[model samples]
Target: MNKRKISSLLAVTCITALIVSGCGGGSGKAEDKVVSEKDYEPYSKYESPVEFTIGRNTSHTNNLPKGDSIENNMATRYVESKVNVKAKVAWETDDMDQKLSLSMTTGELPDVMLVSRTIFNQLVDNDLIEDMTEVYEKTASEGVKNIYSSYGDLLLDQVKVDGKIMGLPMTNIGNQHQLLWIRKDWLDKVGGKLPQSVDDVWNLARTFVEKDASGTGKTIGFGMNQDAMNFSPIFAAYNAFPGQWIKKDGKVVYGSVQPEMKEALADLAEHYKEGLIDKQFAVRSDEEKEALVINGQAGMLFNPWWIGYTNYKDSIKQDPKAEWVAVSAPVDENGKFKTIRQDPVGGGIVVVRKGYPHPEAIMKSINLTTDFLYSLTDDAVQYKKEHASEGLTDHSRWNNEPTQIPMQVDYDDVLKRYYDDIMKADKAGSADGIQEDRVVSYEAYQEFKQKGTAVDANTYGEYLSRIEGQREANNPNLEVIPAGFYGTTETMKLKWANLQKMEQEMMLKIIMGQASIDAFDQFVSTWKKTGGDEITQEVEEMSSR
Candidate 1:
């Protein structure tokens, strides 16, 4: 035999010997024999544990078990025992941006880590991360593949670097558009019809402020965070979306500086002057705003679907009668609800270090988590029982856990299936159709029978998610305009933060009557002069590419 054939024969002989003896150092058993790398599967446990280090960012809001920490949590321990992969914490921090920057400067990156899109691009440009294209295709579970496919071609295409998969994006539900959250009880009390037009919205706000819809002596027509003046659904209603680059007249243009924005600003300024919006909202936090809804100080808000867990929950707790409902943002004369949809491409992505030997480990970890959390199987049932005390059943806490690109299923699809179960139960006139996955819906339905809206926080959140999905699923009037650009352009990197601060300051001043409406004209003039024009040109270049 030639030398090449002799080498191949010897390699085969070693593998066969290991299989027969079952004494190899590798994880594969005789039954799970892998003659080559292509035979590897994500769920295959290593006979001997493999260890790697990861960098983690944490927060108090994570609600990690009392004594458990980022380095030694239930999640880490579970993966170690089950997958035979031990992820030791190389570093942990709350301020990930600063720490990640420091790591990059020192050239001490972890084996695996999650990073923002900006940092991800930087890593790609420097060739610091591994090319996961082949391994991902070979090892990704059906569930993981399906989740990524659901993001649509645009999202998946956006993550590719030179047509090679460099990182795994943390996909978000694309249909998470803003909705107008109003106090249902207040609408009933004022005998108010659902606001159908921008003018109708203004009228309702004015009436709520003038007539005290909350029935409390102290009431505000609207509750909003500091950025709401510039970023809320109100701006979208007028097609004046800020912080978005939109294609106008076959060219990319900044939405904030558009003429439509001036009109939206005028309307918002009028509300500020009329005391329709809380005077202190310019300084308020989201938490404070939610508190206003809870304490009966505000009647209307523009928020996302998940408000049930916080704003609605607190409000319902304080006043059992305080019912809330979500409706689409008011429309224009053309009956178009001009809402600005987010760029389908998400921000967070998980990457493996260039030198790491085990890119497949990330895929394996993802598959295991997917099986534990999503699969409707006996394993998941057992997992639930095992970690019930640690709040494993509450998937919201899963975000805090260590894993690669946490969710392996589309969030909206998960909700849709739960909605299906709920609807099935309703039609059957029995709760048997309700599945374990529909925790919020199931819990809410049970409490709904005893106390109705008095203690229906979980149900309300799930209800809102389902209702919003149904509303947006086929609504032609809902204009789903994509942001022309998502990441920072070259000029933007130099001046965007300053420009945002100036815009926020100028808008707040105009709203508070400290500056004239004409200031907007000056602000736009300055904005274009100071890098905005260059940024637009850059965005045009990027879009063309």
Candidate 2:
């Protein structure tokens, strides 16, 4: 045989020998046989039910119906019926990190759990989690595999340890960059076009404040909370991506300490001094700041497209005439709307405990759930309608699922499909071929079209977010600067917290004018001396690998 074919044959022989001899080194027990592609089925049900325990991370709001619970919800029941797999909640808490830490100490981990990147590393080092490479390859559905492959190697590479896949990385939605949400009605009243540059944004804000566009005599130019100003759209206009690791001059560098951040901070300090930003933003809670926008005291804020689904939805309800618009504005001098792109793999993963008899169960559950939610099957559509009848909204339903690994092939593509196939093709009123998860959004949009101002808050929010908000976020010209690295390093574990605290304090001080603009240089120097330089080197090494 040729060298390539011989090499592949040898590798297969070695793996078979290891499996038969039980000589491989892994936390989990050795497999009895190799599963061929022909024999393996993604959604095959077990002869008997396979039960696994999970340490669930629950939402603060218990949106489950009166008699339902995290363990007994519609998601759990559906999975059980379809795949013959049942999830028993070992323990659930809103604070999963704290509970997981305790579990590590007590040596009492669940059969499967979704954990953060830091926790995933700990589980690997302790050899408490199974090596899912083989199981995943053999049992993962084509749909799930396709989703991971869509990101190339980026998603799976995060969970690979010593060349073995230790966990399933959750693929995050792309284009999660913040957009400037403005009161378009207020802008019309002030007689200004949509902002195209940072200067334009500043001038518009000034006019909004001066004219009191809200007519409440208490209008603030920009609504901000304690941490919002640091990474706001204004900062992005200056190419300052705080909290992201971005490429600078062929090296991976922390965006927070870059020179561009200094310029952004100086500009923000000027705005704060000019009373353009909320004067009390330094002490305002998120809710308090949001209330400023909802109550018509503020005209502009920087948030993701989903802001319409949040407090801005209330803005429409409170004022039926209010018209909020999403924009990729405040571009740089070159007219490029530069924003930081999210990491491909969300820093969370689903891991199975070592010595679990049915490690493939988790893979099966992910497959079944993904198919049920997105495959547009008749059963899935019917299930969604029944759940909606019970007042179960999309916002909180997924929190009740046992295996909470979010698998999206490409959210931007999904949004594009919604825009093209549904909105452009005028199929918003049609349910044919619509996925179970997005049917409600289509329904809500239809209701908003029919009822206009009389539509409920939920319907208004849905239309605004899916239709209007996504239209802005899906801008093809918006330049997204991808983070160079997203993994945690050893030195980072020891010192990142203190370094982050130092950066946060210094950035806030500079923006609020508590410290001079020159303080940024000193902060950068101290950050490097303390741990930033070492962490950067580690990041460089990791990214290179």
Please provide TM-scores, in order, for all candidate models, with all chains considered together.
Answer: 0.84, 0.86
Model 2 agreement with the true structure over 1-545: per-residue lDDT tens digits: 00112234434544453444321222234343333443346677776777777777664545666776666666666667776788777777888888887776555677787898878876676566788998889888877787678666767877887789999877676666778878888888878889888888889899999998989899899867566543457888888888889988999999888999899999988998999988898788878987898888888888876775686788876788777788888888888888776777664688887766677777887876776556434665576566664434445533424333333333324566665554733444476655556667777777877887578777788887887777887787688776799878879989999998898899778878899999999999999999999999999988877
Tell me which residue pairs clash in candidate 1: 27-47
Residue 521 accuracy (lDDT) in model 2: 99
Q: Candidate 1 on 368-429: residue-level lDDT in tens? A: 66666653446655775687676433356335354433433454344455556776776676
RMSD of each: 8.6, 6.5
- Backbone clashes in model 1: 1
lDDT of each: 0.67, 0.74
The segments of candidate 2 whose C-alpha lies over 4 angstroms from its true place after superposition are: 1-39, 58-69, 229-231, 382-412, 425-429, 450-454
In angstroms, how far off is 48's CA in candidate 1?
3.4
Error of 2 at 254 (Å): 0.8
